[model samples]
Target: MKKKITVALLTAAISLSLVACSNKENVSKNEKLEDTVVVYTTHKEEMLEAISDEFTKETGINVEFINLKGELADRVRSEKDNPQADVMFGGDTSTYMQLKEEGLYEKTEPQWKDELDKSFKDSEGYWYGTIKTPVMMFYNKDLLSADKAPKDWSDLTKEEYKDLIVTRDSLSSSMRSTVCALIENNIKTKNEDAAWKYLTDLDKNIKNYYNSGSVMYSAIGKGEAAISIAVLSDIIDNKENNKMPLEIVDAESGSVVITDCVAALKNAPHPNAAAKFVDFVGSAKVQAMIANDFNRIPTLDSALKDSPAWMATDYKAMDVDWDVIGKNQSKWIEKWETDIIDNNKVEKQ
Candidate 1:
């Protein structure tokens, strides 16, 4: 959320503090333990700060956040021999999948995990899911012919749509995961050849390539581009609050959706505090706050019933077989270079 505080610097102070239950700092082992709950997250810093502040008020547990973006998994992997974070929060499911491989995540049994949708949570318990950020087709109503607006994935490849697609960079980014998911799940493809061909054609329609999801939305809203494969919550949050003309369509075929998940870290300095935060946030109370106030779609079914803004559509299907994308990550990236992008491709500002 906020810039990550230094764990190495604070480690000594916290070590000295935990040595004995001295009320010198005004909290003790028996009295809310002064253990710093280190959180590594990619959610917008504003949202993370709010959640951390609320959690502190409710439990009196102090939090030291390690906020990061884009290359978080690389940073965490480098720091794994001496892990700094107690809990990993936010970001797409694939990032967590990579972390799960590094033994960075601990097997935790949060009580709420059982209450979640089975597809959302990991079976071996290295990670758990929350919130529903579904893939959406965000369209600018003013820019293109009404016939150009997309209702489903297939609309992107129409004859008149030859030179009007916008996309993101695939090199070392989560955009590749979405592409990989789109091919592996939504396409009725036992035909990998067809999937490859579609990607090639989609590549040719590029009006521009964007580096940020926020920019993609802004570009679409300003009529700089016609549509985007953006998150539903991101689009609706902008529209409902800022009154942008952009709107999201829940395709007839389900889109690539994922949850913003959190997990206990392996070798955490404060396991008890970490587990408690996990259990706390997974509750209906926190999930509902995420839905109602923060624009996060709830994974808890009870919260879904009340928060229409988050789960307003009947489009419920999410792509399956995430392991295919995770396992074949590099090959898919290579496929992009081979079949889709080149130096001559549209450049992002």
Candidate 2:
């Protein structure tokens, strides 16, 4: 009887030990997962790397990112069933809105949420803006005098500017936003026909549509083209850092200002890490650092105060409904390509 009782007690103790071991293993695995974050972004490699390095240094959380440029959103959509990234960063708010509508984001209220205006963040907390980007017209000062340069989107279609305008491919986010703004502008005036007509006329003057931003900037610097359109940050970078003779055109019709944003993916593998990263990147200190270092405009009201003086320069902002643009963007790009770009290619051939 005593021997049987000893055997039963030993067996029960062993069973409890096994359960404890299994629980420890799971806790270890979760801790490992929390130590790393995977990111997908449209930002340039240099900028992404720098920011990620800072994040890792501050939080001891590793950051592994893929720079997908214009392909980031589509990639996220394809990976919806099994998301490969914990976070998505650096696209305009319109792209984020579309993704949010598809239920692809994890709602996270970053620490800086209340520091920004309602327009800079999604109302339900799905995404938040990190920077402000104004899509503006630029001219090579050496090639075309300020007086002769196109002053507005409408002026680009003028006969005198023929064969002088160069632009990024339609797939570029900046170009897409600009086109959508044009469409929205005309739609508000109840003249959609005028928008299509304007695009067709502008297409006639385009010297070349380069697929690469570096190549396009090179062409402008080398006098291959005198006028172009790009985000303000790039224009400032080229003019100030690269010594390119580019100057911003104070477009009479105003620029389409886009709020570049960040969000965590739905069902991300590391939800806690994603939320922490989102908060870190959009914080006032980080936003100010980005604005000062990269020539970006900050979306945070407090961060804006610390930004460079040039960011304070006044420029007209076109009134735009980003949600409306987000819903119609894909179709508008398709129509632009099919009607304007393809037809022009056929004419040239």
Candidate 3:
């Protein structure tokens, strides 16, 4: 799946190349990217830099972030007996939950364990969430006005948005989590059939589901697609930095908030360093810095005390039972692949 996505992304390199900025900072004479504790991540390069640079500054521990768009859990499972990375960071809660169920984590209590919301951390000390981000619809300002654009999930199926939508593969944790939330919402409302029907129709409007988040966002920025189902933070950051003609709309049914997590791998090459990194990231200081600068909702309650105006402390999010979703995700993904994606034949731009 990762290889397939990589190939598809190659064609969009012209547009997506602008998405990443050089994060290389001059390391001290003794520092090198190769010497850092290895971390497997799905975080954007810039975000990884922001957290890593701060971690290095605070602890003098060089951090090497290996950003993977897909196959994080699969890779971890394959390397379970002999781990390749010290920690897994930046995948959604569902991914961590699945990993935990597979016994892929090394249970250890971090210093900031008590500081996090119980819902944001594993009861068995497997994984800890750093922040939560909403799944939202981002539309191109050049293609549609605010009044004319889709405001919610249901709006995407309307005729106006046909063939103008772009999104990440349903297998991506972020996209899968969002779809799981929508399905759960429908089940709660006793509209299971309607939910599947809505997804089938929405699939008609999507030009293609890209292999990576950067390419998906880049497609929207370059006007290759008018709308994208992605994280609100990605849309905001891209608009602010790339000056893309994009606007975010929270779904009317409330957004699905995905908790990004960090965890120590079993038989980790650098257990102490991984534990230290986990504690430092979830600490009040780093949490507040991330919340203020990146617009991510801090997982620690105290971190919100000084949150910026853009961060909403009291917003209604769709309630999702992550454990249940984690258990059934493979089944759901299989259904999605056969029923929605394979069944729909849309031409890619």
Query: Whose TM-score is greatest here?
Result: 2
Q: Write the per-residue lDDT of candidate 1 for residues 97-157, one digit (tens) a residue.
A: 7778868888878778878888788889888887777766767767755565776776677
Using lDDT as the measure, the top candidate is 2
Worst 10 residues of 3 by lDDT: 1-10
- Residue 162, model 2: Cα distance from true site in angstroms: 1.2
Question: What stretches of model 1 exceed 4 Å from their correct place?
Answer: 1-34, 170-174, 186-188, 316-318, 334-339, 342-349
Write down the RMSD of all candidates, one decimal each. 4.2, 11.5, 7.8
The residue pairs found clashing in candidate 2 are none
Clashes of each: 0, 0, 0
For TM-score, candidate 1 versus 3, the one ahead is 1
Question: Residues 146-222, candidate 3, lDDT per residue (tens digit)?
Answer: 89888777888898888899888854778888887777666667777887887888888888887667777777777
Tens-digit lDDT track of model 2 for 299-333: 88799899998888788998898888889888888
Error of 1 at 213 (Å): 3.4
Residue 45, model 3: Cα distance from true site in angstroms: 2.7
- Residue 168 local lDDT, model 2: 84
TM-score of each: 0.82, 0.87, 0.79
TM for candidate 2 is 0.87
